[model samples]
Target: MEADKYVVVMNSEEQYSLWPADRAVPAGWAVQTEPNNKEDCLDYINRHWTDMTPASLRKG
Candidate 1:
């Protein structure tokens, strides 16, 4: 059996999330990476998402 594929998605607030590759991306979210295994997608998020705070709340 093949493992499920996922994609890294980002919202307007800069929050990262994983979404199934076979499903339609929800409103207000866009794909950030190509379809890949769940684990890889998660790793990408961990490496890239250094800040947990939403973009609106962060003070520059």
Candidate 2:
């Protein structure tokens, strides 16, 4: 089987998720960067996405 491209996505709540690179990102989700392989996407998320709380609920 061929490898699939992937994308790292994020939501208003600051949560991170993975999506198929060939597919359209769902509403309320934004692409964090250009499409990459699964491993790259996971690495990006690990480097970022430190806060899991929703922006409205996070305290300074």
- Note the Cα lDDT for every prediction shown: 0.93, 0.87
Give the best candidate by TM-score.
1
Tens digit of per-residue lDDT, candidate 2, span 1-60: 544898899988888998898888999999997888889999999989787777778954
TM-score of each: 0.90, 0.83
Among all candidates shown, the one with the greatest lDDT: 1
Backbone collisions counted per model: 0, 0
User: How does residue 7 of candidate 2 score in lDDT?
Assistant: 89
Over the stretch 1-59, how does candidate 1's per-residue lDDT look in tens digits? 44499999999889999999998999999999999999999999999899999988986
> Which residue runs of candidate 2 sit more than 4 Å off their true CA positions?
1-3
Q: Poorest 10 consecutive residues of model 2 by lDDT?
A: 51-60
